[model samples]
Target: MSAKKNDDRKSVVVVGGGAAGVNIARPLSFKLDATKYALVLINPRPFRVLLPATLRMVVSDADNLGTTALVPYDKIFHAENGTFLQDSVRSIQEKSLTLGSGQEVPYDILILASGLSWTDPIAFPDSAEDTKAYLVRNHEKFAQAGSYLLAGGGAVGCELAGELKDIWPEKEVTIMHKQRLLFNDTYTDRYRRSAANHLTARGVTLHLDDTVEGLPAEAGPATVLTKGGLKLSADLVLKTTGPTHPNTDFIPSFDADALTPAGFVKVKPTLQLLNHPNIFAAGDIIEWNEQKQAIKAGAHAKLVVQNVLGYISGNGSSLKTYKTGFEAILVTNGKRGGISYFGVLWGLIFGGWFTALLKSKSLLVPMFRKESGLV
Candidate 1:
């Protein structure tokens, strides 16, 4: 450690404690010389709410399930514990941050791990207060209503619908995919067929090649008006329509244009921000042509930490990287069990409970929690 930085409390602060952030912070804290390097993690939540398994949580009262787990800041970051700030980030000024409460925290290096945001009523505002309120209330209504019409048959939408079917077979669950279901032309047809066949076999109404023109204006529980004018109503409308990069409004005056056009911090193979060497980022929130999967996000976080340590040690060239062409997609289809869409055989298929055991069965939440220091 440089005597200068050691005296100055050279530290790393990771923003956003979810997915990539936690993964990065854990290892960095693990590697650091406690007396020389300080690690800090900041997020609004007191604990980590394992996402990806959110589907299982919403499907039923399985909050007690292993993957649907959450834990306080103290649980992880065990040794030389990083500072956990439960506040939103208002802006990032170089290696420093301006918290939502107006407090400023400076870091010798920064990791921006804030993940992606969901696209829906609570997130994207399609209308004013009344209209927005109308849309959001539908989520609450649908949760109790049991019957659901999920819009945008993407990963979140499809998984949620499938899990709901698994939990409440009696309820009608329909998915609206604007294109062919999982139009990931990346996978072979065999794998897609197995996964699709499984979901459809569960009475999941796959409404492909359709779009929701709009929702009925009246509040109390409404129907979705399709492009073809077919009216379909359900207990709720869970629109897993899309996801977008988290807000980086702090970028403009701060070398904003230095990032990818998609606003992700552009980094070298080392994952260091190309413009601000001390700043780095990883996760679905990033704008790499990188795949946006939880495992990949965690992998990216590990790379960032390794490179940051290299940067600290003046051995930046030795940082890690994500393996090229790494693709693994696992899904569960309620009654039909599950399937795998992955590499080598490309769209090679797997079957039954074994398929469900892949990532979706809690995204390795139990494993992460164990790794995070809780036995």
Candidate 2:
């Protein structure tokens, strides 16, 4: 089922409708000359899931945050400039994509924003209804559990611990991380310690420099052994160890060398694929030396859009290069407060009042909704 080419216009196809994919496609749809270029965004879901607020959604569904997180793609693009196909890519060819529906969509320029995969609560199902159900189930689990064990102290794990403690303060919540800090080494030691202290102040237990082992498959009552010779018991065990891998299995079929050993795409500073100048890679899939955050992915999208526009307008020499900006992170602990870090002037760390006003209070859901044309 090969899609007919749009007359003489060339297609600029974007894969995955996550943060990077949608950001790239949204700008391209409005900025591109509709007569000369056709924009296509391919994603498996009809709605985009706002991942940052999912931890709070799992613990509590206040203000219907779970439903608000999943924004529909119907208003993202106009028909004259762009087409949104809710389908997954089965394989990638040199000039076209073979979708799961057996349709082949050709492209003159390609952008791969296919993000990585993560465990549930952070990752949701395809449809909006199913995703709501999934959130409800998790919320119920959290409500019923007397003890919660989070098996990774990354952003997700720490934020989740905060959420659980905020909601059920008496319930035992513990985080077992392999690393010595709450977050990775990208942040300052003082900032990391502050995060740990905030959680500890809320009576959340921290098992730093330890790893959980021998956990059952299901999320029920279980006693788990740790690598640090400690036995822990919990009513529910959740693993938020970060991304499993980038969604780049289809890229190997097109150009094997375009991928790195870790399955991330190799790209030039201009955000173009190493082996294919006509293709671009961004977001978590790109092999960039930085923390994989929404801010970083949004920056990648902006750069890719600029570079792609330049390439298509025959001004490739003037294309902009993507430089990793300073490190800025906002880690929320429930709806009341959290921690924030800015890499300016050595480092600037903010506590609950500032964090709450900036993000934790509303989780930036309103901003995302307005951006998605839902407001």
Candidate 3:
């Protein structure tokens, strides 16, 4: 790690280890020549979260969420060229990052792929041991609760409510969302109607165009009040409607223009920062006007890697452009059934027990393991 040896290579530092960060860093670590490039990935968590499988873990019957989704960094990145550090960035400069430990890492190229933050089970635990405890605690809670209230009509809330009703049919389950329709604006009316019908058929109650104000003070058998004055009682209440903040607060006060009006990093079509060409971004952190799905994030990472390599090779003219296309989502209602919208051209809602077979059975654990080089 001598200064002279390090000076011979270009430092490529990537902040965050979420979907976009890991995907971008793994490829670069494997492809970049060690003598010419230094790849370093920084993340606060010990392990990256597999968000697609988290909802199931929240309501799963399993004692522990076996390593199906959570893949460690050591298994994913190449040792020769990749370096993973568990640290949080405190501040950022034009070409360097100051971590929480007060250590500054200078980089010739920076990639900001730290995705958005989320609540409890949806987000990964800070350590390996904590992840196991979280799964066990949620399993016990789900078993003990007699009634459940899910507040949100988004994919998470709907899917969770569906899972609850399917598992414990005798238990009372209610879902409240501000939107009249399920899912988000990206989905079509046909798909929306299908989800609503399926959930109702599964014996799950729906409260559309309603907002919950707050929960009762009593911990046991609390009554939940809505903004519209509707009241209901449930043993356990889960709020899936919290405000999500981007992890870009580390940016120095001088370079405030890098952030957009909504606080997301503004990136060009090539995924490079709007104001800084040496910096690139992808995933939920970037101000890309599209659904923040894994598919889109993966695509963004591919273009970002290509553009970053071109810039490092002194050939920026070959940068690729990113286009936001039709919205696609494979939403599972529960373990038994689900609905999906593949693309605009497809124009058909795919639902039923077979759709669940594609994901719910194992949450794509084998596929993720193969991608992470665990196999």
Q: For this target, which candidate reaches the highest lDDT against the unseen true structure?
A: 2
Better of 1 and 2 by lDDT: 2
Could you say which candidate leads in TM-score? 2
Clashing pairs in 2: none
Cα lDDT tens digits, model 3, 252-288, are: 4537788977779988899988778899999988887
Please list the C-alpha lDDT of all candidates, in the order they appear: 0.68, 0.87, 0.78
By TM-score, the better pick of 1 and 3 is 3
Quality of model 2 by C-alpha lDDT: 0.87
Q: Give the TM-score (vs. native) of candidate 1.
A: 0.85
Across 57-101, the per-residue lDDT of candidate 2 in tens digits comes to 778877687678778888777544788898999898878999988
Report model 3's TM-score to 2 decimal places: 0.93
Q: How many clashes does the backbone of model 2 have?
A: 0
Q: What TM-score does structure 2 among the candidates reach? A: 0.97
TM per candidate comes to: 0.85, 0.97, 0.93
Off by over 4 Å in 2: 1-3, 78-80
Candidate 1 lDDT score relative to the true structure? 0.68
Task: Please say which candidate is ahead in TM-score: 1 or 2.
Answer: 2
Which ten-residue region of model 2 has the weakest summed lDDT?
366-375
